[model samples]
Target: MLIGALLILTWLILLIRYPAKALPVSGAALIGLLLVGAWMYWLDTREARQLAHLELRLDYAPTRCPADRPLALTLKNGGGSPLQELRWRIAAYAPGDSVNLVETLYDAPRYRGPGELLPGDTWHDCLPLPPFRPGYRPDTLEFRAERLQGSFAD
Candidate 1:
């Protein structure tokens, strides 16, 4: 933005330098438009995008029940493009047969990832997930991935 402002100032200065001592109105307008266009083009080229098959793993790294349980998740941006500070929410569900109902899980840790992940690289995140409901035991767990503004095209 600062550079854009400076360019505009320069253009205005040129226009005032020679009211009718030089160039035509169309010529000046063309130059100003080109400058702004070039700036926008550079920004678009650097903007991050989402590529497919970005692997994400959520696992029960370790658990002791009702006391101190730490959940670890790995986000691998395996695609070619690097994703920005994308807002995504992940929820993990232990099978209903796992924990007890008395343990009310009301909140979980929410965070924002800031590193630039290259292809084949992994980003690790540790979240304090809600306590697992007590029960017999869980055979399978399910997780859902949600993004604030879905796809870039959409």
Candidate 2:
């Protein structure tokens, strides 16, 4: 924006100084600005496409463990592009006696993945969880992928 302002100020000064050359110079400047704007828009759209082409799917496996209460989950890259440095959310819940009730719920902090997840690849890991709230045991667990960032192939 500052550059644009300076260019416009310079153009106005040129117009006042040389009326004969102002028309052609202003036309050239306008074309240059339009080309620059179009180039910027194209770059932004390419970045958006890269983001859209990255997707993920999460699968949970139930297992029994006395101490850690470990939960196994698999994260799959389901898009055309590769994904890396993923952040995820893990949550556990214990259902209540009545329908649609949650007796106990626990949410862990955001989990950062270690390495890149190539296209069509799956990452399997176990999440160690502490015991559920007193008098409540988890009936459902959820693993969600969030804040995804990746690049698409050219």
Point to the candidate with the largest TM-score: 2
Span of 10 residues, lowest total lDDT, candidate 1? 145-154
Segments in model 1 whose C-alpha atoms lie over 4 Å from true places: 1-51, 63-69, 94-108, 131-140, 148-154
Clashes of each: 6, 0
Clashing pairs in 1: 98-135, 99-133, 99-134, 99-135, 100-133, 100-134
lDDT of 2 at 90: 46
- State the C-alpha lDDT per candidate: 0.55, 0.58
Per-residue accuracy of model 2 over 48-77 as CA lDDT, tens digit each: 665565544443445433345355556666
Model 1: per-residue Cα lDDT over 1-154, one tens digit each: 9999998887678778876744687487789999999998865543433534566666655553222435566777666665555455655555653323223434544545545666677887665554445552322555444453212221
List where candidate 2 sits over 4 angstroms from the true fold.
Answer: 1-7, 19-25, 58-74, 84-114, 126-146
